[model samples]
Target: MREDAESLDIRDVTANWVNAAVLDAQIKERIKSLADLAHTPLFFGRLDYLHDVGAEQAEGAEGESFYIGRRHVHDAQGDPMVIDWRAPVSQPFYQASRKNPLDVRLRRRFGYTSGELTAYEDERLSDPAEAADGEHTSRLLQAEIERPRVGPMRDIVATIQPEQDEIVRSELGGTVCVQGGPGTGKTAVGLHRVAYLLYAHRERLARTGTLVIGPNASFLHYIEQVLPALGELEVKQATVESLVTSDAVPVRGTDPAPTAVVKGDARMAEVLRRALRSHVSPPAEPLMVVRGSRRWRVPAYELEEMVRELLDRDIRYGAARDALPQRIAHAVLVRMEQAGEAPDDRVQDAVARNPAVKAAVKAVWPPVDPAKLVLRLLSDARFLAEHAEGLLTADEQQAVLWAKPPRSVKSAAWSAADAVLIDEANDLVSRTHSLGHVVLDEAQDLSPMQYRAVGRRCSTGSATVLGDLAQGTTPWATTSWEQALLHLGKPEALVEELTAGFRVPREVIAYASRLLPSIAPGLAEVRSVRESPGSLSVREVTTDTGTLAGPVGAADGGTGAHGGTTADAAAAAAGDAAVLDACRQALKHEGSTGLIAADARVPALAAALGAAGMPYLSPGEETTAESRLTLVPASLAKGLEYDYVVLDEPSAIVAGEPDERTGLRRLYVALTRAVSGLAVLHTTPLPAALAGAPTA
Candidate 1:
C-alpha cells in the first residue's frame, strides 16, 4: 500500500468503529429479520447518574421503597430563579462592592438579603432552601452577578450593618479585633472588610500587603467564590495553620498530582503565602520549611510543680512577661502541672491580660511546692509541644520534649504582615499570639480556656470580633460571652452584637435556636430572625438482638446497672435491621445519608448491605450521593455533615478528657449534617441530649 491511501476508504481493516461494511450489514440484517420496527426509536435510552445513593427498585409497594434497582432523577426543567438587579435600591450596592469590592453589607446580604442579586464573585446563592420570592439580600447577590465587573468603585453600595459596625469597619487601627457569633456575619464582614482595607489602604499598604486568615480547606471550598462574585480577585486567604506554619499542607494528605486537587493546593498555598506576605513578612518568607522547630508539649501533671517554673524559669519572657498578673502567672503554672500543659512563652507576651491562665495557675500551684509532685517540665519524651497547645491531644500524657523555636517563631510570624486575623482563633494553642490587628470567627463556640487563647492574640489595635455567642454548643460552650468579654482590656469597645441572620431559613434558624441554653439569651436575635418550615418527627424500632450488647443503664436510670440491660442477639439484629432499613429509606431522600459507626470495623453491618447488592460510597472517597451506603468513622466526620445520618455505636462510652474537648464536637458536627433525615441505631439507647437534635 502507498504511504497515503487517498482513493481507498479505511473501513475493512480498521477497528469496529462502525465502518461502511458494519453499517450495511447491520441495516440489511435489521430490514430482513426485524418486524414492526417502525414504533421503536433509533437508539436505546441512556441515564446519567450523579449521586452515590442507589436508586430503589420498583419491586416495593407504595409509600415503602426498596433499593432493588430503580433510580431517581432531578427535574431537568426546574424553575430558573430571577432577581431584579436593575432596581434602584440595588444600584448603590452594585456600585460600592465594585468600588470597595466585597463591601461588608453585600457579603452578609449574599445569602440572607437580596437586592437584584447578581454575581459578587463566582457563585450563586440561589437555592430552594431559602424563602421563596426575591429577598433584598438575594437580589443584591444577583446585581453583583449581573452588573459589569469593571468601572470605578462607586457603582454598588449596600450598608447591611448598623452605624456602629460601619464605624468599626471605617476605623484603620494599628491592631483591630472583631467578635460575635455564627450568622452574625463575622466571616462575611471580615471578608468584606479585607476588600475595604484593600480599597482604603491599598495605596499605603498595597494590595499585596493585605492578608486574610481563613478556616480550613473545606471551608475555603465553602467560601472560595465569595470574592470573585463582586468582580474582585480573591485577596490573600490563609488558614490559621498556613499562617502559623512556614510550610503548611492544604487539607493534609491530599495528593499533589496534577488536576483540580493540585490546583486547589496551589490556590490554598498561594493565598496563604500572599496572606503571610501581607501580614507577617516584609517580603514573602521563604516557601521552604525551617528545620529544628521547637514546640511546647503540655500534659496532665499534679498542679503543685507548675508554680515553681512560673516563679523560676522563663517567666522572664518577651518584655510583656514582666507585666504578668499574679493570677494568670499562677494559673499557667498550675495548668502546666495538673493538665500537663506547657507555658507558651510566645503567647504569654501577646495578650493584654490572661486571667484564665492566672486563675488556673493559682488553682494549681497556690505558691506551694508539695513534695507529693515531681515537675521539672516533666522531661521524659513522646509528647512534643510543637509550638504550644496541640500537646493536649495525647491520651496518656507521655514523655515531654523541650521544643524551643529557633530564631523565635515570631521572627517568621512577624516577618510577613503587620496585622493578623486568626481564623478559628479559639482553636489556637495557648501560645502563638502576637499581632497588631486581630479578628476571630465563631467566638460563641469558645470556652474560657479558648477565650484566654483569644485574649493572648489581641493587641492595642481595634479588637473586632464576630460569632454568635448564642451559637455555643459542646461542653466548652462560652457560658457567658459577656463575662468572657469582661476579661478583655476594652469590654465596652467590644460590644458589637450583630442582629442579622444570613445562613438558615428563619424556620431552621428558629429550630436551632431552641437548642441554645437559656444562659446565653443574647442569641435570641437569631431565633427571632429564623423563619421556619421545619417540624420534628420521631420513629421507634425495637433493638436488634444477638451480636449486640445491651442498653447500658444510664447512671440516672433506676436499674442497678448504671447502663441499660442487654436484650440479647435479637435486639442487636433488630437494631441492625433498623439501621439497614433506615439506610434504605435514606438513599431515597433528596440528599445523601451518612453512616457513622463507632470505629472503622463497620463491615459486619456494611457488608450485609453490600451483600444485599446495594451500592456504597466508601468513607473518604470522593463521595457522591448515588451510592448506597457511605461509611464514615466518627473522627473523620468533624466539621462535615451528610444529608442523612445514621450513628451506630456498640457501646456508647463517654471516655476521657481529650475526646470531650475535641472529639465530641466532631461527633456533633457529623450528626448535624443531615439536611432531611436522621436515624440513630444503637446497641445503646443513645444519649438523651442528642435525641432530638437537628437533622443537619
Candidate 2:
C-alpha cells in the first residue's frame, strides 16, 4: 500500500487517501460547486487564468483563455478593468517569423525566446465581424456565455498556485526556470494558461492568428484534444523538429540528398497504412473536414487517425488507437514538409510520428538489406563479440556503423513535431536541444547547467522549464545558485515555480519534498515544503533465478506464458519472485504496494512478480497504463513512476559513453523512477548502485 494513500483495500478509488464513497462525496460537492458556478456565476467574465495567478500570459495555446475583452474584465472591486503596461505601446507575440508563425511557435514552446510578441492595444484587433468567426457573443451582456461547439474550455484544470502565476506573468526576461517533480500536473496547467492567454487577447490574435508548439507527436495528440473541447478552434499547433525542416531530417552533406523529408504526407501515408482501414469521413463524428479534396475520397475526419494509424503501425515493422472522438477533429493543413507535399499540418504530424517509414525508406533505398549487412557483421561473432579487432577495415566499419539511427530515436515522433516536451527535463538533448520551445514537463529533475542548455534554446533565454528540484537522485551539472541565476540569464523577476500538484494527494507533499536536492540560490529551498496527507512504506521481494531448485517457476517465470494471476496477486507474485535479497530491505509500502525496481522489466524466474509496463501518455492511451507484466528495460524506465518496478535483468549493465554501458546515464536514470518502493531481481550478486536495497 502507498504510505500516502488514505486506504489500500478499496478497489474503486485506488488513488485517494480516504474511502471511495467518502472521497466521492467530497468530490461531488466540489465538482457540483464548480459546475453550478459554471452555470450561473455572479461574474460573466471568462476565467482569466494567469500563468499562475500574478500577471502575464502563458506561451502555449493550451493556456490561452476565451477572452471576453477589456470591457468585460472586472477588478476584484468589481469595477471595469484595464492593463496599464500597454498604455504607451504594446508588444506583439509575432516577431521576425511571420511567414510561418506556426514554425516559430514550435521554437517558442521549446525555448526559443527570440520570437517575442509585439504587444498591441486591444482596439486594433476588435474590428472583425462576429459572423467571420461563425460565433456570436454579445460583448455587452454580463451573462455567462457558451462558446461555439467547444463546451467547457477547461474541466480538469490543474494550475500553478496564484503566487507562481503572478511571477510568471509579471516578468518577461531572457531566462526563467520552473523546477519541480514528476506528477506535479505541470503540463496540464501550462496548457491551460496557453488557452487562457489566447482567449483573453482574442482581439490581439484570433484563433487563426495564433500558434501552439507542443512536445512530440504523440504528446501533441495525447493532450491536443483539451483546447478544442473548450470551444476554441483553428490555432496552429506543431513541434520544433517539424517546424524547422517541416519534420525533414537534414543530412549535413549527402551526395544525392537521399530523402530530405522525414515527415508530412509521404510520411503520413506510411502512418495511415499502419493505423485503421481506409475510411475517411464518418459524418457521425463530423468535425474533421472543412471540405473534402478530389484526390482523397474517404471521410476527412479519418485523415488524422489515418496518419496516426499508418505511422504507428509502420514504425512497428518494427512500428508501434484513437477511439470515440470528442466530436473535435484535427484541422486539415496544407502540406509543406516534403518537396511535393501540399500545405497540410495533419500530414506533418503523421509522418513525424512514424519513424519506421523513414528507417524503412532508408533501409530499402540503395537496395542494401540492413538484415544482410547486420547479419554479415553480426554473423561470425564479429558484431556480437565486442573484443574482436580488425572485423573490417576502418572505412568499411564506418560504412556499416553509419547505416541508420538508433531504433529508439527512429521510433520516436519527434522528427515531425513542432515543439519538444522533455518529460524528464534533466535528460540530455545532444541534438534535440536545437528544437525550439523545449518544454521540460518535469522541471524538478534538471540541474542548473541543463537548465542553461535548455534556456539557451530560447535565443531569447526563454524555455518552458518545470521541475521540483526535490530529488537529488541525479547529479546536476550546474553547481551554485549564483551560477544558476547567472546562467539562467534572466532577471529573478522572470523566474516562476508551480506549487500546485494535481497528481499527488495533499498528504504526499511532505514526504515527496524530501526527494529534492540542494540547489544554488536559484532553488536553495524549493524542496517539497508543502504539507501533504499521503503515507509511505517499502516492501522487499527476493528470488534467486539460479537457486529456484525446481521447475515450479520457469527459468523466466514472467507473464508472457504465465500471465494468469488476478490483477492484485499477479503484481505481488511478480515482485516476490524477482527482487534481490539486500535490495529487498529498501521497500516499505502499506497496502496494495508499490514495488520500485531498477527498471520495469522482470528478471529470470521473477516474471510474475515484476512491475513492468511503461505507463505513459501515448495518444488515446493515457489511462491505458494499468499494472501489467511488462518486460521493461531499465534504461527506458528512467524518470517515470510506477507502483512496482521489477529490476529483473540477470546482470544489469551500465556502460560509459564509448563502451556498451548501454546509454551512459541510463542506469542512474532508471534507478530514480520509483516514487514508493523498489525491487531488484537477479540470478547472481547485486550491482554497486543498488547496494543499499538490503532490508531488515
Candidate 3:
C-alpha cells in the first residue's frame, strides 16, 4: 500500500500547480496511513461463507473468505487480503451466531502476542454436531478482554460484542444515547461509532467534520490514541471547557456551587436571550437618503414597523441588523419608482450604504459584542434584573450576580460556567458552526446549559451520548438521560442500556453495585461477566499511637477511626502507612497500579510516597514498564482503569463532596476503576451500604 501511494505520479496526473499540490498532499496522507505499527495486528478475525457472497458485500468481488481487520488491505493484483471491519461482508463476524450464522459456515478468531500470530480459535457454526453441543464461549475473547495495559487506552475493534456492534452500526441520520454502567464499554462504543460513521460517510463527514467531547483533560488524554489506533486520524477531541472558551477568554476563577448551578441552568439561556434582545430598540428618528439630487424620507413609524417585523421573525441578531439597512433602502427604492425614475439593484445597494440609512439601522439595531454583552449582564444589576424578571427568582438572581464585576471582558475572571454563558450569547448573535457527528462521553457530569453548548455544535448533525447515571458526582448532574437528551436537542434519539461488564471483574463490580441504590436509585446494577477469586479486599487498618498495628478483615470489628479521621495526628500517620502498604502489595502484581484517594488527601499521600522513595506518576501520565504506578485523585478517577488499585479512605472521598448523595456517587466511581484486583484500605468503617458485601 505504501509503495502504491509513493509511486503515484502527481506531477504527470495534474495539469496545474494547484491540482499538483493537492494530489501531492493526498499521496502523503495515503502513505502515512499505510505505515505499519509494530505491535498492532493488521487483522484479527476471518470469516468463511457456505457460498460466494455478492459483489457489493465483498467490495467489488464475489468471495467466500474474508479476513476482518481494522482497515482494508489489498495485494498488487487488486485482490483483498483483508476486509475492513466496517464493510458489509465483515458485519457477520460480530453479529453472526449459531442460530443465525448469516450464511457463515466457519468463524476464526486470531490471537496475537506483540503483533505476531500466536494462536487461532475456530467455531463451526453450520455443523449440526457443534449445534447440539450448546453455547460456546471464546477463551480468546475473554483473554483479550483481560489483557493488562501500561499506557493510554487501546481500541476494542477485535472484541466488540454483538450489542455494541448494533449501536456502532446505527444509521448516521439519528442520534444514540448509551446509558451504560461502569465497564460496559460506553466510551469505546461512542468512539467506534464515530469511526464507523467516518467510514460509512467519508466524503460527507470530511466536508462537515466530526468531534469527540470528554469530561476533562485527563480523560481526553487517556483516550486520545484509541481513534488513531483504529486507522482514524481526522477526529478532533476536546473538553467542554475547551469547546466554549478560547485563549482570548481563559478561565481564571471559579463560581461557588450555588452560583454555578444557577448559571448553568437552562433558564439562563433564556435570560441571555432576553439580555441580547434588549439591545434592539425602536428608531427615534426618520431615515432620509439623498441619491443623485433626490432626497427620500422614510417615516419614523415605517422604520419602527420594519424593526418590529425583523424582531418578530426571530432571526440572528447580526443577520437582522444587516437586513435592516437593506429593508430601509428598499423603501427608498419604492419612492424612486413612484417618482417615475428608473432604478436597479445597483441603485438600491448604493442607497443601503448611504450614511443616513446606516445611521438609522445603527440606532435601531446596534452591533452587539457577545463578550461585552455578557460582561454587562453580569456586571449591571439593573440590567440583569430586568431580563431575569420572569425566569429567575429573587434569590437565584442574587446568587449569579458577580460581587465585584470587572471593568471589561479582558479583565474579568471568567469561570467555566461563565464561559458557557458567553458561548450561549455568542450563539444568539450568530449561529455556531455545526459538525457532522459528535460523541459526548462521561456526559452525566454536564449541566443543562453545557448540554446546549454541545447541542449547538451538532445542531445540524447527530450525537452519541455516553454516561453512567451512577457515576454522576456534580452538583447539577443529570437526573435522567431523557432530560439530558432534551437539553441536547435530540430528545428523539435512541437510548440503549449496556449492563454487561467487560473491563471490571465480577467481584469488584458486585461490590461497587452495592452503592447503586444510594447513589442512583433508578438505575440498574452492572452485572460483570468475568469473575476472579480474591479480586476484592477491604482492609480495616488499626492505628495505635504513632505506629501501625496491622490490618483486619472487612468483617472484623476494629475500632480505630470514625468519619475518616483519628483521635490524634499520630494515628493518622499510621493510616497513611497502611495505605502505603497496600500500594506496595498492589505493585507486586502485573500491569499498572493506581493509588486513588480523596482530593483533600492527595497532598498527604504524595508526601508519604515521596518520603518512602517510591516514584509515582500523576493521572493522565502514560504508565511505563518501569513506572506503572499512578496516583489518581478520586475526582479524576472516573474514566481511568488499572490492573490493580489501592483505594484510600472511602469516607474521606464521600466527605469531600458538597453533599452525601454526590459524595457516594464520587465514591462509586473510585470503586470501579480496577480491572483485576481492588484493595480498599481505610481506618474508618465502611459505609453502611458496603459493609455487608463479601470481602477477601
Candidate 4:
C-alpha cells in the first residue's frame, strides 16, 4: 500500500500548474495528509460480507472483504486495501450486531501496541458456536478501555459504540446538543463528529472552515491529537478567550462574579446598541458641497432625514457612517439636476470627498471605535444611565460601572468579561466572519456573552454542543442545556442525552454521582458498565494536633500558613502531608496521574510536589514522556482526564466557588476526571452529601 501511494504522481493531477510556488504548497499539503497515517494503525477491524454489497464486482469475485481504518489505503492496482472509517460501507462495522448483522457475517478487531498489530479477536455472527463467546468480546473491550493513557488523548475510532456512531454521523446542516455525563465519550463523539463532517462535506467545509472550541489551553492540548490521528488536521482549535479576543489589546484579568454576570447577561446587548446609537445626534447644520467652486448645499432637514433613515434600517454603525457622506453627495447632485445642470458621476464623487461635506457628515455620524465606545460608556455615569435606564436596575448599573475607570481606551486594563463586551461592540459596528461548523466542548461553562461571541462566528453554520450540566462550575453557567442552546443561537437544535459511562469505572462514577442531587437535582444519575470494586478511596486526615494534616504548601511555592494556634498549624501541616501521600500512592499506578486541588491550595500543593522532586506540568502544559504527573487546579480540570487522580481538600474546592451549588458542581467535575481509579484525600470532613458513601 505504501509503495502504491508513493508511486502516484501528484504532478499529473495538477499538470497545468506551472508555477513552482503554488505547486509546492499543494504538494506539501498532500504529503502531510499522507504521512499522518504512518504513526497510526493502518486498520483496526475487518468486515466480511456474504455478498458484494454495492460494488461492481469482477467476474470471479467471491465476496466483499473490507478492512476498516482511519483512512483509505489502496494497492498498486488501485484495489482497496483499507477503507476510511467514515465511508458508507464502513457503517456496519460499528452498528452491526448478532441480531441485526446487516450483511456482515464475521467481524474481526485487531489489538494495536505502538502502531503494531499484536492480536486479533473475532465475532462470528452467523455461527452459533462462535457467537456464544461473550467473554472474548468483553475482554477485548475491557483491555482497550483500560489501556494506559500516558500522553495526549487518542482517537477512539476503533471502539466507537453504536450509540456514539449515531451522533457522530448526524447531518451537518443542523446543530446537535449532547448532554453527557462524565466519561460518557461525549467529548470524543463531538470531535469524531467534526472529523466525519469534514469527510462527508469536504468541499463545503473547506470553503468556510470548521473549528473546535475547548474549555482551556490544557484541555485543548489534551484532546488536540484526536482529529489529526483521524486524518483530519485542517480543523481549527481554540479556547473561547482566544477566539473572541483576537484584537491587538491584551486581556489583563477577570471581572468579579457579580460584575461578570451583569456584563454577560443578554441585556447588555440592547444597552450597547443604545449607547452606540446615542452617538448619533440631530444634524444642526446643512452639508454643503463645493464642486469646482459651485457650492451645492444639502439642507439640514435632508441630512437629518438621511440619518433617521439609516438608523431605522438597522444597519451597522460603521456601515451607516460610511454611507452618510455618499447620501448627502447624491442629494446635492439631485439639486444640481433640478436646476437643469447635468452633473456627471465625477461631480458626485468630488462632492462626497469635499471638505465641507465630510465635516458635516462627521458631525452627524462620527465614526465610533467599539473599544473607545465601551470605555466611554463604562467611565461616564451619565452616559451609562441614558443607555441602561430601562435595561438595568440602578444597583445593577452601579455594579457594572468601573470604579476609577482607565484614563483612555489604550490604557484600559481589560478583563475577560470586558473582552466579550468589546467583541459584542465590534460586531455591532461591523459584521463578524462566519464559519462552516463549530464543536463547543464543555459548553455548559460558557457565559451568555461568551456564547454570543461563539454564536456569531457560526451564525450562518451549525454547531455540536457537548457538555454536562452537572459539571458547570462557572458563576454564569446556564441552568439547563435549553438555555445554553438559546444563547448559542441554536434554540431549535436537537438535544441528545448520553448517560452511559465508558471510561471511568462504575465504583468511581457512583461515588461521584453522590453529588448530583446536591448540585444538579434534575439530572438523571449516570451509569457506568465497568465495575472495578476498589476504584474509589476517601481518607480522612488524622492529626495529633488541631490542624488536620502536615505543613501545607501552596501551588505557587508558598506555605499554607494561617494565623492560628500551634496545634492548628500542626494539623494543617499534617493535612498537607496526607495530600502528598495520596499523590505518591496514585503515582504507583500504571498510567498518567493528576494532583487536583482548589485554586488556593494549588500553590501550596505545587510547592510540595516540587520539593518532593515530583516534576509536574502546569495547567496549559502537556504531560511529556519524562513526566507522568501534573498539578491541576480544580477550575481548569473540567475536560481533562487521567488514569489515576488524587483529589485534594473537597471543602476547599467547594469554598473556592461563588455559591454552594456551583461549588458542588465544581467538585463533581474534579471527582469524575479519573479513568482508572480515584483517591480523594481531605483534612476537613467530607461535604454532607458524600458522607454516606463507603470510605476506601
The sequence of per-residue lDDT tens digits that candidate 2 reaches over residues 373-406 is: 2223313333423322323344333332324443
TM-scores, one per candidate:
0.43, 0.37, 0.96, 0.92
- Tens digits of per-residue lDDT, candidate 4, 1-696, equal 444445556566665656545766655666677774444788888988877765433212224788888887776667677888888888988888876778788888888777778888887776666556442444666688778888788888988888999999999999999999999999999999999999889999999999999988888888988987877879999989888775565688678899999999988999999999988998897766766657777788988899999999999999998898788888988999998999899988887888898888778888888888889878888999999988999898888888989997778888888888899999999999999999999999889889999999899999999999899888898888888888889999999999888899999999989999888888987789788888899877776644363324332233577446676567666777787788788888788888888888887777777878888887556546767888898988998889999998888888778898998999999999999899988776788888887786
List RMSD in Å for every model shown: 22.8, 22.5, 3.4, 3.3
Q: Which candidate is the best by TM-score?
A: 3
In every candidate, how many clashes are there?
A: 134, 136, 0, 18
CA lDDT, every prediction?
A: 0.38, 0.33, 0.88, 0.84
Q: Which candidate model has the greater lDDT, 2 or 4?
A: 4
Error of 4 at 471 (Å): 1.0
* Candidates 2 and 3 compared by lDDT, better number: 3
Question: What's the TM for model 1?
Answer: 0.43
Q: lDDT per residue, candidate 3, 115-226, as tens digits?
A: 8999999999888888888668899999999999788998999999999999999999999999999899999999999999999999999999999999998999999988
How many residue pairs clash in model 4? 18
**TM-score, candidate number 2:** 0.37
